[model samples]
Target chain A: MAPLGDNTNIAEEVMVAEAEKRPVSTIVIIIAMQTEALPLVAKFQLTEDLDSVFPKGVPWVRYHGLYKDLHINIIWPGKDGVLGVDSVGTISASLVTYASIQALQPDLIINAGTAGGFKAKGASIGDVFLACNVAFHDRRIPIPVFDQYGICAKQTFPTPNLLKEVQLKVGKLSTGDSLDMSPHDEAAIIANDATVKDMEGAAVAYVADLLSVPAIFIKAVTDIVDGDKPTAEEFLQNLVAVTAALDQSVTQIVDFISGKSISEL
Target chain B: MAPLGDNTNIAEEVMVAEAEKRPVSTIVIIIAMQTEALPLVAKFQLTEDLDSVFPKGVPWVRYHGLYKDLHINIIWPGKDGVLGVDSVGTISASLVTYASIQALQPDLIINAGTAGGFKAKGASIGDVFLACNVAFHDRRIPIPVFDQYGICAKQTFPTPNLLKEVQLKVGKLSTGDSLDMSPHDEAAIIANDATVKDMEGAAVAYVADLLSVPAIFIKAVTDIVDGDKPTAEEFLQNLVAVTAALDQSVTQIVDFISGKSISEL
Candidate 1:
């Protein structure tokens, strides 16, 4: 296979050239998935969280990392709507992520994770997309439009422009904290819903924004809310394709930014 | 002053008592203080939306009456914290006052308002003490292994157990969403570095804990946090007496809940 790479060496050149113009900080890429990180790790021929798992501070598996100038990290934000619902996982993990990044005081942050897709038709498994905006998936204060938006104190930093760059092939995305596994039939009946659903995106944006770090949130679309209830294992198995796509995208994104000028990037 | 009467006579009692006795639904109260709806409005005054100001709607303000039980109405999950130092006045006028007994869900909630009290020998502001538990004001997290605990998800709720309710000399209190301009010290300190600091009590127990319909939160501390630099306006202000009292014991809490049984008084 020729691979998702563009032999034109076009993306890397485009980024490096741009870097010469505008200032670009060392970019960090994070991936969030519900399954094991081995396959993805093997593909890149990189050692995973081996250090953390081997000596074993925590017997249970978890994801956190400090890689190359890329600074990639990974985590499993829990699955099944009710079991691990709420923004806390995202907030807590993001806090750790932010603290780590803040130490370096990087200029930008990029988060990649898996999410549920709710399309009516070709909403197949393992598709990749980018989120434009994110909402608290679990928070639903359904006040009528006639009612005021009321007061909510929140901090959401700007989504990286790189997200906008992928809008063409990937398409737009929406996020909420709740994992809407209501099955396609039931979800279709709901009055309001989003195209993609995930938990961490907004929380990451919030903390990153608070610290003045621009952030990019991307996710692989894994499960479609179909009538037949799929197990978490099934969902993880389906994530393989999307995972490969994510790896390719992150490298390209980094190289692309590398090419840009400091001022213009 | 008159008694609060039995909760049963209060209507929310007749409607909620049965359900609350069981445990299907839970009520939670958060005092953001942005919309100053009368405390009683949640109980008796039924409106589509506060009539004029919110004739249209109030986002999170919920109104649910039991089937065929019209008098049984309660509103909330109101704003979490007061708007800001700016909107404190206009919004508080219509939404808050010390006159009404607003009926909010959650049988037990704490009014966590911001305050400017001194930890300094004579002028430190910013302390969180339980009204009743206020017997002793000084605290450090996990001290006495009981006080100053946080009630986030994955943790057990704080159960004060009506800690020996006493007599009522200064009972029958009301909540105000307005910020008290006292103890200029807080203006010099708070807000600059907290997720939130408002015109109510420690919002911790009120918002995070899962409770029945009898929750109530009251915060009587100062409401603004500038920096250690108090300006001319802050220096001449008389804040000691009131704040000192707010920092006093909660002995009256039990007496207040005395005559009022789970049913009617």
Candidate 2:
């Protein structure tokens, strides 16, 4: 948490035991997976939290920065690489990398990533895979698909209470083993399911479940099911849709956090 | 979904699905993220589900195969660098990410990354930061802490249920903003946290709440809090620690997925 600098400091949020302040009721943490943390930070109005830094929190740190005028410290878990691809799947490896995120007493958490698309009838590149539910496409038992569920892991995922509570258009998500580039096949896979194929959805879902935070996972289909790679690589504009959606979601989440959505706290 | 060649197809657990013997519940897909997927083909296992060709998820693709398997997949909503250092503060993006993951139906999840330790505590160049709970670290209001608990996004993270049910051991975790990698500060941050630092845990926690999956998130203290230049390049062991932890986490996660221990899985 310290390596991220004062910008990621949570010391400001800490209530001095002597202060005798109210116990924070609704604390939320936001994680932006994959790409760098610049774009998201660009949209926020930040105010440093000066009191929290010291022997307890990060050194050379300020209080904490604000995002969208909301309160919560942020971290960029960093671009991922293989921890042990030989033993664990990419998704599983990702889940264990941050084994202590649960330490923070957060009522809610979220994971966001860029995903490839399966050529679904209505699905196209840059579409947000607003996962209604996520599953391992690669996992399969020795059983046939027509009979029973495949060999899926037992890990849990983040809850989507806010996902449903917030009114927005969403597409289901499907997990896949490989990056889908073929329009025809991706289309077929999307045709089979009502979502997009991403690398981290299942992993994030698994972690959130363990933490018991009401999670709301979402992804922006970066490219078409077979959108030419390198052809569209430069754009990476796929995140734009996700950002747009996030911009919209903030209003609702903030409303809920402030107790304005359900009942004024 | 189609890139997986049909050559390798193995099942771990078996059950009678549709009256036919099949894997109980598991699916494994193999792909290359940043480092290219071909060389690793030899590392492929029999318990894999190939797409079509032998060693074929997407036959003849020269992908970098980036991620080496970090334990947690903290998907950031930042696409094309729209965010900044503390961009992960917003729960909206994180919540959206959580919703995408929930669709997968995992049982547990977590986030891990590199963080800067700002203090001169035990934060070592290659230690880790383990957090018991995440504090917004930034929400400072004029009202008393108790009165404004609603305004703050500080909270606690839920434990991984499977780990509890199965009894898995957990290490340390911490939170902060500074990437304390100075030989002294690095040791301090590492001594204090676990051995890592990075942003995104809080968001991951927030999303995990929605999914109901327990999780753990920690970052390898990559650099010192007071130093600049990303210490990632300066320290070798610090880099190693993250990868090692990531590897350790991969095995654990796989065991969780396989319903077996690291050795058994």
**All candidates' TM-scores?**
0.42, 0.36
Q: Model 2: which docking level applies?
A: incorrect
DockQ of each: 0.03, 0.02
lDDT of 1 at B23: 30
In candidate 1, which residue ranges exceed 4 Å CA deviation? A1-23, A30-90, A93-102, A142-168, A181-193, A226-234, A259-265, B1-162, B165-265
Candidate 2 regions with alpha-carbon error over 4 angstroms: A1-36, A45-70, A80-100, A141-167, A181-192, A226-257, A260-265, B1-265
Q: Pick the candidate with the highest DockQ.
A: 1
**How do the residues A182-235 of candidate 1 rate in per-residue lDDT, one tens digit apiece?**
232133223223455554565565445434455666666667755354624445
lDDT of each: 0.36, 0.37
Give the worst 10-residue stretch by lDDT in candidate 2 chain A: A80-89
What is the overall TM-score of model 2 with all chains considered together?
0.36
Residue-level lDDT tens digits of model 1 in B130-178: 3321111111112122222211212112224433342112111111122
For residue A122, give model 1's deviation from the true position in Å. Answer: 5.1
The docking quality of candidate 2, as DockQ, is 0.02
Docking class of 1: incorrect
Report the Cα lDDT for residue B65, model 1: 36
